[model samples]
Target: MLRKAEDVLTTTDVRRRQVDERIRRLESRLVREHDEVPPSLVHEWIERASARFGDARVRDFVPLLVERAVRASVLGFSSDQHEMSGTWLPDWARNTARRLLADELPRRWAHTAGVARRARQVARVLPVEERDLLVAAAWVHDIGYAAELADTGLHSLDGARYLLRAGLSRRVCGLVAHHSGASAVAELTGMAEGLAEFGDERGRLRDALWYADMTTSPDGHPTTVEERLAEIRRRRGPDDPVVRALAINGDERLAAVRRIHRLLRRTYKPARG
Candidate 1:
């Protein structure tokens, strides 16, 4: 019985070392990618993933399972899509947003879900190359609202800054910074110049992102642009800086939404008999 107990202890120690080595290798591979995801963040994800398997009887597969889970968390790949190529920005964005906002800001998470859902629907109107990017922007647009990330007190700029450091493309960072007429608000808060760092993007991608955000309700439901605007006004009240910024740029936002509607209508095709 003592020999058996010693064997079990040795087995457990070996498994722990194996898991750590596998995680280290996985971290090295991930850090080589373009984003070069932070090693600390990668370790945190590995710990979270490993925690889920604590009750399992068989420990042989734990290291492999944790590696796969952490890789998915880092690269935003679903289990079936691990072998697939092309950047999965939207998935990464969704995971990042969830990590930051799900526990700390439930309502904001709902809003983000709604906007990302709407962005996916609207992406059909954009060119193939731009579709996922629009969805990606929608996913992380409000991450600055996360309590720990709200450094600038301006969610748009703060969120954009976070994404930029996370190695997101400049275009995505720009969209997050300027979503929903944030330029007017930035100007009001003296952050307009800061926003320019991402450069101003024009045309359909911008319009579609705005349309997705404006048409989604805070509860993650579809809503007309007017209703959505009214909801914000009601929630924030007229004294809010966001509401005040809306007063300045609301018309321009409305125009962008209308432009998207026209584009959608133009692309609409009646069912063929």
Candidate 2:
């Protein structure tokens, strides 16, 4: 079971393969749909990002990331999915998911990026094996929010289901599905299927994503749980979805956030897994 879990994570192979496949798919799509970007330019970024990550394979995702950015432009995505996906990127998938996120919820794009950035920050604290999934999920955490699929409005559930349908790995799919969990949002959106679909992940990947998202600011900056909650209240007020989410969760979200924060501190303070 232990080795099986490691093999399941696309931590290396599937991620690279997906990046390569995405580039090919997007290039063909662009040709059919009109040029979203130059093939050469997209290739350039993938090459550059690959070099930056110090992993030759990391080079594969750049093309895919750039293609998504161009698509985001076509969609009038205000969120700069390219930038968000690229934030703190280490020569790879950092910006790969941005275009999709941008297409989904430009308003929440920055927030998702912020979560990814924090995931990068905390990567140093996690086991090397777990970091890849954490980073990948960071980029993909909010993919369900795509306007076309934001059906349940609980982006996690919707996004997870979408990836699973697209044939993504169970580990990556699970991470995205329940990154932050929809308990609060699910109560309101009425998406029990998405909620129930997120099965047990093999590692701390889900927990890491949840912790990072809860601590980060929606404006794409870092903040504490105490501050994050206060800001939610101060900005969204009591009648808003977030406020109402809190009400429905019976403060469970807040408390869970608090617990996660404590774990993050202990896990990340010395910066070792």
Compute the lDDT for candidate 1.
0.76
Question: Between which residue pairs do clashes occur in model 2?
Answer: 46-62, 49-91, 50-59, 85-94, 85-95, 86-95, 104-146
Leading candidate by TM-score: 1
Each prediction's TM-score versus the true structure: 0.67, 0.55
lDDT for model 2, on a 0 to 1 scale? 0.58
Task: Estimate, for each residue in 1-273, the C-alpha lDDT of model 1 and write its tens digit.
Answer: 999999999988998788767766765555334122222244456667768875558766776777666666645412212121236888899999999998998988998988887676566678778888888999999999998788878898899999999898889999999888998888888888888887668789999888888876787766567777899999999888899999898998898888887775455421211
* lDDT, residue 48, candidate 2: 42
How high is the lDDT of residue 220 in model 2?
62
In model 1, which runs have C-alpha deviations exceeding 4 angstroms?
A: 1-86, 270-273
Judging by lDDT against the true structure, name the best candidate: 1
Q: Write the per-residue lDDT of candidate 2 for residues 111-206, one digit (tens) a residue.
A: 877777667655544566667667777777777767765766777877777767766677777777655535666656666555877674634555
